[model samples]
Target: MNCFRIDESGYTGFDLLNADQRFQGASAIAISDEDADRLIKQHFPKLQAPELKYRALSRREANHPRLIGLMRDLLSDFRCVTYVCDKRFMLTLMFVDYAVEPFYYERGFDFYAGGQNYAMASMLHMAGPTLLGKPQFEALMAAFQRSMKEKSEEALRDLVAAARATNWMELPEVLGPLAKYAAPECLEAISTPDLTTDVALIVLQSLITRMEVMSEGRYRVAHDQSKNLQTYTEFLQRFIDHDANVEFRATEITSLKFPLKLTAVEQVDSKDSPAVQLADVMIGAAIEAANNLAGLRSGGLDAEQVLSLYADDQFIHMVPSIDFEEQKRFRQGSQSGELIDYLAGNVFGPKKR
Candidate 1:
């Protein structure tokens, strides 16, 4: 089998498992070129070898977020694994979207497991259906494209209506293309062509739930102090009610002293800082909520399936410089006077690419 191994300090990727005996102490491991080919053939019998491709990502060229975003873009719908090689690595059977195309081929190698390590692989593949007709695949893709274009609920309703009217439901069984656009609510409505009382009730319930969530976000962002306080109080009540006998303490409370007064030369962190580390917690919550919303809309949860959305990694960058001539002056190290003048020109500049 083509496979790769990463044993604590050494790692290697290859076309065959000839050196399988050397795989030891691997924090994470994955199959290589030849083994990978065999594995895919074993599990996805219908998929052909020509449809598979190798992709590697290096830490030196991209950070984790950027790497993840790229992974989502290129292999969101494909299976991939990492082998603790400080790189994003994966093998894909198909291109999910525009994020991955015209795959490139490159080569370089390093030592692994007390021996020389080297391998060759291509990063792209051309997709062809195993049995489904080309026109069938094309129609399925058209449905998917229609779904992607319908962002609003009303638009989604229209697409769902049109799909049912045109009999696209039968396509999902033979082609995976419609899976991206198949929504649960639409499925329910389709199953019960006539809206039953239960279906109506469920739709109403979902609407109420969505409205409550939107109201909460609005309250927080609009600085509606009264609403925020009321919402917090209700949350505490529900939380305390969950285990009435247990002691409970508020973990988050606005500090009584904010923007603490300090004399010159007395170092103190900004009082605006949070008492607890919430930046990471909030970021995680945001990711989870977004994931949930995406799942609710799509009616499926495939981590790889949604990768294309984040392919173009966007991030903030900070560059230190002043206006035109002064930036050049600073770079040139004109003089001590120039340094002071540049510093005085602008204390901070906006983040730039």
Candidate 2:
């Protein structure tokens, strides 16, 4: 563990790594008094009392292979590699409040590269200095760490609000712009699907997630001329396909005097023409069917029967715009086996023996 302390000179020690070895330099890294205190709590999780105090303060500009490595670990745990890899971007993000430099523009390339990072950083910028006040930032960012974390829904709602109010205000523009390039038949195919309000809402929500991620991804590539933005454009296209067309079969619980089977087409986008309307109706119909089944399973529509409402959908949609392989690789590397299994639950549900 590399320990950094604040010296009388207002600087700490930094070990910057060069190609073959290492050289010591004055600490260019800055640490606030509050940051030092939090650092202690992080390392000594069990230390509860004044017994563990910031007796001294030090700053190490080291990539603190250990500390930075742990940060990478926690970030991976939260799927944050997209943020850390681009230190320059984060630095700009940190300074966003001090100034809105030309660096803040969201180029098309940034839409694909480190998209999540860009979303987060943009979120922080939009959410403002309140976000800089440690507790607030941690609370807000904690949502990105786990799929099922507490308050994540609330955090996401906040994100939705922020996204809608800011750069994402023109999401509908994507539909119009892309419509220009795609084949008329393909565009028609994309546009003609029918969807209901409920399904449309879900589709909109999913697109928001995708776009936020894309923003970060594009930003990463945009910042680096060496990086190509086309990959992100391809990513967007694939994500759209996977999210709208990827399909699997599931036995939906239904409730008619005579049971009926519903064919659910996965990956329906709401902003697309009629298809979104159709998907919404199907979802609604499915819910109605599930409710009927539950009511029958439990005598006389007891409240407890509603517990089944929590059951996972057998076949849900993935965005075709994303690269499923890339997403899968991301999930496999960052999450635990159980978390991965939980995600797959939507695919397999309770398999019939």
Candidate 3:
């Protein structure tokens, strides 16, 4: 079985609405164990820095010929799959009205009129059952209603303060039910950009897809150690077991399956694993490319150009194509366009040639 190493960059925990977090992505690098050992021994010693990271290389050796040469060599040596999400566009497209508004309407509250009160109501309604339990959620709703009637933000603030005083896990329960209510498509859309679950799904899918075509669908996957490793592994196992389907917008629906066999999934330290370090470098490059696309940076190697140098389709696959026109519309502040129409035109349409 072939072996692949995975790593991520540009994760901002789970704050989907944070404007500062413009990008989120992950990368998987496929190589045989012998090739991995050989490549690291051959290339790592030539680097001036002890570690292989995109940010450090960009900052300290942006103009270094050796660094550029090393990057080129790494790209040529491994098969990489990367997925990047534009967090700002994703949030605006998925959450604001379609999710938040309908959630409030279901509870007989006018989301627009209540402003912050409405926001608090939506949060409590979504998170209540899961995090606060049904009883506490209902009580919080009662408090919020009282505040809304009296035109005060105090009750909502108090609840939020209490939630903050507890664990961070207690705070983001809003994501789950909100995603469920949004249903089949909305859940996928919302989760697609998530730092944890959705990102892992796509990365694994990409790896499986590439392996099916290139390596007879057989591989052992290794990843850099992460707090979410178990969760990610469970998700992958479930997808394979149940034949889960992944829909890209509406353009394509694919069964998340491997044609051959997956031998193992394991985690390794990047400090000790050259394969994981290479995955890190690949993700770093992807992050830089995403930043350039978002206008956060300028004048560097475009990610597409680097992928082209490898001369293989499986070398790099960017989830949600950077060329997607709806992304352009969202970036241009035209989010008021009908969601269905947008999906039909951009996502559900036949793949562009």
Candidate 4:
């Protein structure tokens, strides 16, 4: 059976809309146990404390040319899969929809229209430092504060009512002039399910899909041990087991017919697992590439250039191609014209009809 190790970058708890949080990425590496040990002994024999992490690699000092070269070399030895989340757009969609319930409910709070307003305000505030700038963020905050002070309950109800009336297709109109200020990429990142859940599913789905395509439909997965990740894995396993016949989507191609059967799902310490460490490095690099593409970072390899080296190269798999241009057009009300109707049809009605 093929063995894979998984690790993640930029996990900021359930507060996906935090101003400092930009991206959430998960990386999986498929490598033989023998090769994993060999590579670790050869390359990271002297691994130290506060060992390599994505955030450190994102910095110019930590991502030195030599280290980059070493990472490039390591890429050749394993099959890699990565999923990056656009938190801003994900949170925005959640705030306006029923998806926000899970987030608040998980924290012992009941979700309501008032909660939606609070979430929207938080999202806007978080976007201020990066997308809107300090001044605009303050202005938006002032507007929100005024609304709260004047007619807090009524305003929240109105906002919720408006959101209920609108759909994904009508986001631009619903947002009005404020739509322009919202990044096209952000708006486009919205998906049917929440972003974190989508990423988790995609990562596992892609790993299993690739395994089936390369080998048989047999594999075991090992992920870096963490309480939060453990919960996610258990939830995902339940999801998979509950619907054995459900087709796996979210691959580069179309759906996979074969049901994913894991020989075992294990969590291991990164300190002991070379495969997990490699996954960490690869995910960090993927995050840096994404940040470069999003204009959040610079003075290093361009994202497109780095991605091209791995594109369809059989080594690295980039999941769910992000088309900024297409997303921009969608934001401008050009493409996916039926989005509103589609959403309206899918979303629950007042009477659950």
Candidate 5:
């Protein structure tokens, strides 16, 4: 069995749109402990206290070169697998999948099967605020997000009120399509709490599956000690044990060998685990590169070099970005309108009804 050490960056539980926690990055490496230590010495020969895991290279601007150098090893030597997601986009996806999808599914339509969830999430993320008026839409999203963590009747009522509040607050034409689903009738779907609906937990779960698919065999995992991981570790292990089929519109999405291979999950101190620390640098660098790429922040790391490492092996890396113009305070530069223009001008066929 191959041992993989995994670490995460920008993990802020469920409230994702906070200014500092916009994206979640994770990297898993198969490098042995001895090799990882040797590589660390080369990167930071004079490393002192707190070690590389606690003092991550991706955190400081000065250490970016060493991060890129180490990332080269990930690209060539170990062929590490990584995962990154725009948390804001992910929240919108939860809004669509959890709340909106069920509205249609109850009527016998498969929301994901039809691939409407993707389009809906993208549209909402990029233009929902503009179409519906930013304040009310954000309020509605906030209520839904809070209810995801707490499944109380009060939370459900707030979400329903937020949805209905949009009728008067949003543009008339836009509310017609959304009003039905957002209506309180769909409270059962929206209010049903799911432990597995968490972002960090979901990232780790998806990354593990992708890792299994990329490198076949039973797996042993070592993760950095975290309350977050501890919070969802059971769900993570349980998620893999099930051999359920994931069909999107009558097509199978799972191709990994049966019983879904996993041997054990161990939470370890990064001070003791060389590979976890190394994985930390990789994940941190990936998140920095994503910020630079998204134009949310610029010049903390080499976007070109970090992104090139991603191109080396496509299957082992899953980096999905949802960057577009928006009027949000944190998304100030999004007003440039470059991405939105491209999205609009792209040629595409309409989905089948």
Candidate 6:
């Protein structure tokens, strides 16, 4: 049976709006225990730690070069994939679902029918602050987060207050289709918003899709996030028992039968599993690479090596779309556009001839 070591990074529990770590995700790598050991030994011959941690190694000047060498080796592997999501973008999407989509849904229509969700998600992500003011926009997100946790009267009041504070006439571009739902009663529809399991399932689903093709549907997930994802055992257990269908709704419908090739999901300790440690480096590199693209890490970043080493489709980049017009209006596309183009180029590594 094939074994894929999986690990998640940048998770802040159910709170999606974490300030420090904006990216949360998981990576899956298919490798034997022996290969993982051999690679680690080759790179860190005088290793002293029980586990090879990417974050720790990147911090030390002497070890940074070795870390990059190890990452390049890992990237050379044929089978690996990383799925990352922006927490704020996820929350912004939820707001559109709760406050905006329902109005269209009531009229026997799909809110996301015409790439509308992408447009709205991008618009709200960028224009929301301009339309509602940053404070109110944040309050509304907090309200959405709280409302989904449980029925909180405080969350409801905050939602109402945020809606009441919005002057629809100011930003008609966003408020045009959204104005109908700008009222407090319409916003009250945000009673359920579960983002916790949402991300985990996406990570798992994407991992399963790629693993199915790579392993011929015969593999078990060796997960290493027992603390933050303790509840995931049951969800993964479904695959072990029967052929489960995993589906994701986005631009299109993605559905597949699982356990056809998958056996079980074992929650392994990272300290013992070199495979999981390798997965750690892969996922951490993905996050750090994104940070580099966003200019989050202004200082030296050995992790930037991931940009060149990454396979075109290996790393998934899911960042929020900034209000492009607003950016152009302020900087005349001098700063933001240049950064955006640079990021795009790095994301896929110069086009093939």
> Top lDDT: which candidate number?
6
lDDT by residue for model 1 over 1-353, one digit each (tens)?
21111111112222111122121111111223344334444433553333321112111233234334433432243222211111111111111211111111011211111110111101111122223344543343344333433335554455444434443333332122223444453332222222111111111112222222223221111001222123323322232223222221111210111111111111112122111111111122223223344352222223343333332211111111124343333223222222212222322121110
Q: Model 2: per-residue lDDT, tens digit, 1-353?
A: 11111111101111111112111111101122244345434654554443321111112223123333333222222211110011222322322211121122222322222233233344443443342444443432232222112224453344333323333223322212222222222122212222101111222222223223323222111110112222223332333333322222111221111011111112212232221222222232222233344342222222232222222322222211234344434333232222212322322232110
- The clash count of every prediction, one per candidate, is 8, 51, 0, 0, 1, 2
Relative to the true structure, candidate 5 reaches a TM of 0.79
Q: Which is better, 2 or 3, measured by TM-score?
A: 3
Off by over 4 Å in 1: 1-157, 162-273, 277-353
Give me the runs in candidate 2 sitting further than 4 Å from their true place.
1-54, 57-148, 151-155, 165-353
- The 0-to-1 C-alpha lDDT of every candidate, in the order given, reads 0.24, 0.25, 0.49, 0.49, 0.63, 0.64
Residue 311 error, candidate 3, Å: 5.1
lDDT of 3 by residue, 214-290 (tens): 55555777877777555456655544443323222211322223223666677777677767777776677667776
Model 6 residue 62 distance off true place after TM-score fit, in angstroms: 2.8
The sequence of per-residue lDDT tens digits that candidate 4 reaches over residues 26-114 is 76667765676676556546656444554554455544544465466665655666666665544444333322333333355433322
lDDT, candidate 6, 1-353, per-residue tens: 77888888887766788788777888888887789999999999998998988888767778767877887787786478888888788777766655665566566655544445555777778778887788877776776677656646775666655555666556554444334344443344554323222455545655665676677646778877568656456556654565434332222222344334877788888888898899888887778766667666643345456667778556665556555444234323122222222322432133110
Candidate 1 structure lDDT: 0.24
Off by over 4 Å in 6: 170-189, 193-198, 239-255, 258-260, 298-304, 322-353
Worst 10 residues of 5 by lDDT: 343-352
Best model number under TM-score: 6
